[model samples]
Target: MQTPPDRRSFLKTTTAAAAGAALTSTIARSANAAGSDEIRFVLVGCGGRGTGAAAQIFNTKGNVKLVAVADAFAANAERALKSLSRGENESKVDVPPEQVFAGLDAYKAAIDVDADLVIIATPPGYKPQQFEYAVNKGRHIFMEKPVATDAAGVRRVLASVEESKKKELMVAIGLQRRHEPTYMETIARIHDGAIGDVISQQVYWNGGGIWYRNRTADQTEMAFQTNNWYHFNWVCGDQICEQHIHNLDVGCWVKGMYPVECNGMGGREQRMGGDASKSQIFDHTFCEYTFPDGTKMFSQGRHLAGGWNHVGEHVQGTKGTANPGGWIKGEKDWEFSGKKVNGHQQEQHDLIEALMRGEIYNEGEYGAHSTFTAILGREACYSGKVVKWDELLETGTELAPGIDDFTIDSEVPVSARPDENGLYPVPVPGKHNPFA
Candidate 1:
């Protein structure tokens, strides 16, 4: 069995190699060369989001080309390529049939292709390994958030961030809200004291539901779970880390700090037709996160249908209150009336523009930290205990142990098979040990 590479050992080896060679100058020259020519990129996970991201890259103002693409299933890769080759995106996409890869190890082959950027939109559990590989290859990255499915994964990304900085790689995490004009203006005001002395905050991702894929007779357990990754803890990190991360990230952005400690409660209800066996995740979670200054942020995320739903962030300070989406209701009320742009598209533009100008920006560190914040909240909810940030990060269980060795036929930690009572082992609040 092969586990993830140890961060310390990897860093030690890479650092020693870097010192012996002109790696820094060589990478700088490569980035400069890319700026002058068409920036070639590869897509590692060709799902809907990955395909959309590749489209956005084509839409970016640049001489850019898609060189390769990969996915866990060959169908998805073919479909994404077909979709991208239609109409306007056709000329921009140049991936041949030979460049299309499938299976668990497909990401490595895609990354090994001749490309300047790697777009990683795989399941969160695989992100750490993929990111480390990209950084080692000295490729700029744009990976979707949340970055990881567990604390161990978070630590892995954090370690990779350092190496990326040393390589001057431009990394972008898909927390697109940070790139939106409305959010950028509104958060700037909050930071500038429009909402004076931030004291408390609230964020949400309460929604109706998400899609579920039924197991097919031909599919193995690993393939089934990978296809329907959201319901499993080891891959998706539940709804909190997946869907709710946007709001939680906004909360942290507004406060300008990550939570020091958090205690949360969550349980599965009204999910998978009310059958616990179908999902290993909670449909609803409420978390109270405390900052170092004693200020608190309250978080609510639910997937239950027919409930009052909200999907935004709010900050309450000494002088006033604000909605980070676009407005402030403080001493002097204000609303944004600026030119609005699609954040999803804008983020790609920023990355491309920055690379062309030779300005390297690495969003990986903050992105990893915010991701860990969500993981902390999830663990707190699972264990029904106050989970401190440092403790959980340093010594939490690896959700997908020996993840690098996983194949379509390999066994997942959480079994898809049901017990005699036809129930899966959903986490019990008092008994679930996230650290074990």
Candidate 2:
């Protein structure tokens, strides 16, 4: 993707000093209170996204360094280090071999280093626990989203958000759309009634399935499960929570709150045969979420190949309709012709800026809410029942059971139990109850 001219201008012209010129008195004071001229950061997950985030942080307009890295597997950390040390971000790598740790408990050792910021980019199952630990250590954070696989994890993240505020730690969540200039401008107009009252909304992330890791002979059950976490409900939270959450989040942002209730249905249409023990997740989910104002959001996600793929949001209002990421039609017709910076990079830009300005920036609550929103839709689909926000959060169902104390030989939360010939248990509308 080419960088938009406007985005280039913003990145080129908006230096910390330039941005500070228009800061409020409070923000200016906060900026002056910034603790250090050099900021050291650590990464908890050394996957592709983590490496990309580190590159973005290095691109930020201030003194920054990638000091340490941790991962569930040593191979991933080694890959990230090699990649980071060879490219344009090579100068930013200061992590000694001793600073790079591996294993399930590696994050704690990395977080204990003298660092100002920590990037929690691990799988969703470990996000809440890792994020909570980062907050407790008083380190600023840039965490990936859907922050958790279930509501129990969402509560922990929400609590961490409050604690972050009290500690004045800058926390940025990877809902990259919210950081995009076009999304910000368009959503602001919608909120200002540019498209009148939003009557209905549609969001989607219908596309092909993600990569599947083949289990090796030496890999233990827990190792294989952790390596292939995407196929397990205890880790990835199904397709809805893992990938479709981005679109669902846009719906919630447009509504200014999470949905009140959701009734949905989903199933595994394409996944079949072979090693049935490898997966326990659905490939498709359809949900109808009702916001507090009675507005309805229809959402659908599928992973089947050779199907129509649509990955965007459409909002229909009384006066007109709008594609919040693009343009509006009807009475308030407008288009976002702005220069585009990469949403991924822009999120890091905003976070670094907030930290530099000493202004309080916390996306924990919003991230958790959007994550819960995804979970609500999944729960509805999973159990084939209407799921309410309040009740869902109180279910206290923890995915990845005993994850906090798991060794390579530990039993997985959900066994790959097959019936008869070979077929893992799948959600069957009225037959399966995820919450129960």
Candidate 2 lDDT at 101 equals 96
State the C-alpha lDDT per candidate: 0.84, 0.79
Model 1 C-alpha lDDT versus the unseen true structure: 0.84
Q: Give the per-residue lDDT of model 1 (tens digit) for 312-408.
A: 9888999999999999998999999999988899889877876665566667766787788899999999989998887888888788888999999
Which sections of candidate 1 miss by over 4 Å? Answer: 1-29, 32-36, 414-422
Write candidate 2's Cα lDDT for 1-436 as tens digits. 0111122232222222112221222332232213657778899999878989988888899678888999989999989988888867788789999999999889999999988889999889889889999989888889998899877788888888888777777777888988787887888788788888888999999997788899899998677877887887777888898889999988877766567789998877786433456678888899999877788999999988889899999999888999989799977479999897798988888777766666646666667877888988888988898878878887736666667887667776653444566466666788666566
Clashes of each: 0, 0
